[model samples]
Target: MSSTFSLKYMSRRVSCAFNLLQVCLVVAVLALLVTASPLFAENALNGAENTAEAETEAGVAAAEVIQAPALAAIAPAPAADEPLSPRMRAALGYVAQRYRVSADALRPIFHAVQSTSQELSLDPLLIVAVIGVESRFNPFSQSVMGAQGLMQVIPRFHKDKLPANAGKAPLLDPVTNVRVGSLALEEAIRRNGGLMEGLQQFAGATRDEDQTYATKVLSEKQRLEDAANRRLGRG
Candidate 1:
């Protein structure tokens, strides 16, 4: 009986040891699975973060490219035409106001001056200066010396140079005055060689000192230009 009891006790001790060993092995395997799961989760999160960063950078690049073309399209273009002449533009305004007419009313006179000046190879400003001085753009102005129209043309001179009945009509008619004045100015320019000498020639015998007449006419031209600038609010 004692021997049988010892054998049974030994067998029971062996069975308990084996069960404990099995529990320890299962615990070790569960610990390994938990640690490896965390590593895999961290790697997946890092990959997702990298992908999101790349997408954000791509969006910023796309925005820059889109805005580049849009900004270029909206940019202002440069002006491509010539600017107007201040002197000529101011002269036109003066002519409009002094004549009490619209700018269009003097288009013919402007064209005549331009055409005649070109044909005579004269400065249009010189012609305008003479017109401003002689009559203040008044077509019918007559001098005490019987000089008629804007040019203060002498009737006898017109008879010699112009067609018949040239001086019989009203002296202040703008078209007739411009025609006669242009012709006389052309003749004066021919005799004098250039604008300066022609101006001197036009002033001859008109004043006690020849330079005095030229000075007066030039001064008048300046006044007209000033008046025009004032009206245009450029003064």
Candidate 2:
């Protein structure tokens, strides 16, 4: 056989082997992706669990923050997607999980809280904590005291605070409820001369003297912050 023909055959064999190797590598990669996809999905779906360690840290951080006299010193929650900070992501993840609600559903409310907190010089987490305590984020929640919506603002008492038109319908709207509820909370804090006093008045539990309502609200806010700090690995 000619040396040329022999060399050509040898070259063809190497080329074929290389092509087969490439095909095998591609197949292996595809198999890996297929097998690992569910884990990725679960990780995405269970993002709440990813921040569990933050809960404890969040508790301590939250406690410190609530006692600080001004919630505005704490980081502000994000209202927009484009500029979401790590803390905002953690807050959303934690609250969504804590309240047993979807991130999508929680977002607009968070945005409203952000806007209202900014407007009122109040901490956004405090508003979120209020929502958690009053309604667990249920936009349609109503109380026996005639309180309605996420913030549990009784329409009759807070008519002036409700969105224009003097109706209870606006109170049921999650965004509107958060905005108005936060305003109410801000006013309560102002009238009572402090955060604790304001919270007591807001809950109409001023006579209790134990300040249970304020403590619960502050604790809830602290948990959110701890979770956020933990998620950021600050915990």
Candidate 3:
């Protein structure tokens, strides 16, 4: 009986050792899974972020592709009856600021200048320069010698050059003045055979002291040309 009891106690001790070993193995496996959990979670988060970034980039590219043609279609076209180009407007503003002239008053006259220059086959800057020197754009200006208006055209001498439709427009009128003066200048150019000589004759500068008149007009013309060029973005 003593032998049987000792055998039983030994068997029970071996069973308890086995159960402890199994418990230790399970705890070790659980620890290993816990250690790898953060790594797996980090990898999943990184993958998700990369996918989101790619989607955002694709969305931006698609938006740009969709918007491109719409933006082009909405671009403004040049109008048929637009009175002034941006460059022309800039040129006018520059001249008006530099000369202290009323842009409102002088603006409409530029159209006339352009048309008249084309009709007369003359450089528009030359006429504008002469107007600057003659009356500083003052429509009511009159000289002691009876020269009147912006270009100071002498009414008595240039009466024949007046437009037939002028009717009773005075020499002080801007349109009639410029028309008559341009015609007179054209005739003077024809008679003298050159621009400088024609300008001198137009000024009636017989004395040597008046030699600077043509030079001043030409200088102003050069300034205006440069202003126009700058406005056109060619300077």
Candidate 4:
């Protein structure tokens, strides 16, 4: 073979080999990138899951804050009977009869009173008495002073006591009204340092003559207590 031909032939072979090597390198890089794609996607998914978990924890923390006060107010159960014993049933019956309300209507809302009493460390009977004096178990009752609902709580004054889910429903809603009213009474009692004083404050009675309102409430409370005792055979 001629030298020029041999040299040219060898150069062409080398060029072909270099081209093949380049193709192989490009294929290898593409394969590596494809292999890494799944890892990248997995990392993104894990990050999203972490964010969701963090949000869930934050929601739970907020719920705890809203619920802690009510939970902490619960007292130990009575040893002789459940919190709403036969005595309480009698009281409910008496109130229902005296107020001309349906016993079924009174029965359903006893849960709210019990829950409030537990949360506020107050007596359910006292709450019932207050309701009797305030609205006579009328959920739709409204006062001339803008006081509304079964407990006649002024909505604007106690808006902070409303539950988160309580939308634009009128303050006359029995459940919402009772909850806020009970909280207001709890605050009044705490502020005045005595039940009678609290009742006076709740009634907006600042003067000595204003005590009549408190006296009425106390009288109602006694009547309900008597009724409950009678039912339990303790009268």
Give lDDT for model 2.
Answer: 0.84
Model 3: lDDT equals 0.80
Give candidates' CA RMSD values in order: 19.5, 20.6, 14.4, 12.5
Per-residue C-alpha lDDT of model 4 across residues 79-123, encoded as one tens digit per residue: 222345576678888887888888767765666787778889999
lDDT of each: 0.70, 0.84, 0.80, 0.83
Candidate 2 local lDDT, 66-176, one digit each (tens): 877666554334456544456666899998887788997787777777766778899888888888998888999888888988989888787787656644388877777
Tens-digit lDDT track of model 1 for 153-224: 776665555656554563455555666677787887688776556666775543454566667767766776
Number of the top-ranking candidate, with TM-score as the measure: 2
Best by lDDT: 2
TM-score of each: 0.49, 0.64, 0.60, 0.63
TM-score of 3: 0.60
Error of 2 at 193 (Å): 0.7
Which is superior by TM-score, 2 or 3?
2
Candidate 1 at 8: error in angstroms? 99
Worst 10 residues of 3 by lDDT: 75-84
**Residue pairs of candidate 4 with colliding backbone atoms:** none
Give the Å error, residue 174, model 2: 0.5
Model 1 reaches what TM-score against the true structure? 0.49
